[model samples]
Target: MGRPKYFTPNEVSLHSTLGDLWVSYLGKVYNLTPLVEEYKGDVLLKPIIECAGKDISHWFDPKTKDILTHVDPLSGCVKYYTPRGRFVHVPPPCPRTDWCNDFGRPWWKDNRYEVCSEETLDEILKRYLHYNSHAHSYTWKHNGVSLDMSKTLSENGIPDEDEEFFDARMDRDLFSLSICLYFNDDLTEF
Candidate 1:
């Protein structure tokens, strides 16, 4: 089934089961059913399964979009603060030779698990149309790459620059970032 642009908390709660599990963190909902299927019977899945269909926003740092971490007093080392206990992807407190690090990236960092974001590219384009009537004829892109209209700006590697601009104390009109929009040749005038 195609994922929706938004999922209510109740809708997420409905999928809390071993066969199907979903979780939301840092304002993005993720369907982790495939992870469960892949790591079935693994002890690390206990914490994830226990909080299925629930929002785990508290588990992450909003700025970094990573697990919340703190310095371990005993070892004076920083570690992920998984109160529910360290699950998959999180390294053990003490290094263990048996521990695996072959996984390229953690599940949260993987886009495959993403189900929804705050706004989609389609919605953003519609908003642009309000200002420019011919916006529909232009293909959206970032860094010279075409964007997927079904995904959000962040998913397309378009970082929000408003904060950076504001930090520099530059007026929006004086320092504008350019987004090259090429009119689609296939678009026909009616």
Candidate 2:
């Protein structure tokens, strides 16, 4: 019962693999655990293919930066608001570090968002990867009775050997501002 993604018990069911559906979905070569397998269809590949019309490593980040500025599907608006007021969208992998929304922080005292942006393929891709069971967290806050998205992928896990490369790219930013950025879902994407 969320925006964009309408999932109820009747539309889909994953608890029972229904024969070898789960095992077969993940080929033996991947050696993928259940954590990664369940999301491959409904959350991962389906969106990727739907977006770029290809299954390439679109999830993988490059040395360059990507920009995004999508409109709000719910409000039909194209502006972002925070403690700092409104702003425009940037592409993939925003290097913004000044965002102050800390509710999505891993160390936050309490989470409050039910879902983030999933209006378009790009937004969905970013949130889906970050919201996975392992790589990122589904944070929330309450605007009255409504759940607000605190989707974040700022800090987690071990860094690659090339620490400088990752450092220059990620900017060590948190998910206070729900902008379009490359969610660090390395484990799930692979």
Candidate 3:
């Protein structure tokens, strides 16, 4: 093996732009600039923009194992490439109480908050990779085909009620919303 590379936090901070964005996870650094164009309008884009040129080690808990792979010649880091681009689809409001509970009040409700446009599936995955490995339970693969929620509940040994509770609390749609009146400008106005 060759000698490992080293980068200071300041060095990482200098690269925080769409043209030269870099982020450090674990002990390695990845250049995310190549993904900038493809990730435009994605919910993950906001976090990526915020985290550009920073050591994201603090954002992730150290207990979690590395869920991403590292490729050589790419600075021994994994590139953020999602084959499906944005995976979470913001479905139209459903009448089911379960759905409403997971996504907060219905969009038509006066108290309903405006959803953040930048809460993409990739951002959720990044959070999962950093904080809770168990969140991976929401994903699985079978018979040469992969499914996102194949094991969301079963692997965790969670009861149906607990699963519903988890969905209600951590569901991407609800978690990313801001209590704002106008969906465009007033992201924080309640």
Which of candidates 1 and 3 reaches a greater TM-score? 1
Candidate 3: list runs displaced more than 4 Å: 1-4, 66-190
Ranking of candidates on TM-score, top first: 1, 3, 2
- Which prediction has the highest TM-score against the true structure? 1
Spell out the clash pairs found in candidate 3. 43-118, 43-120
Error of 1 at 182 (Å): 41
Candidate lDDT scores, in order, read 0.80, 0.28, 0.43
Q: For residues 1-190, could you state the per-residue lDDT of candidate 2 as single tens digits?
A: 7454422222222322322121111001111123224334433223322222111112222333221234666767643222222211211223367644432432111122121222433344454665654423322322222222333122122122223434455432221333333334344431
Candidate 1: give the clashing pairs: none
TM-score, candidate number 3: 0.33
Worst 10 residues of 1 by lDDT: 164-173
Residues 40-102, model 3: lDDT tens digits: 666646755776787554333334322222243536554432322312122322234432235
Clashes of each: 0, 12, 2
Q: What C-alpha lDDT does candidate 1 achieve relative to the native structure?
A: 0.80
Model 2 stretches astray by more than 4 angstroms: 1-38, 50-67, 73-76, 79-190
Candidate 3 lDDT at 1 equals 50
Residue-level error in angstroms, candidate 1, position 97: 0.5
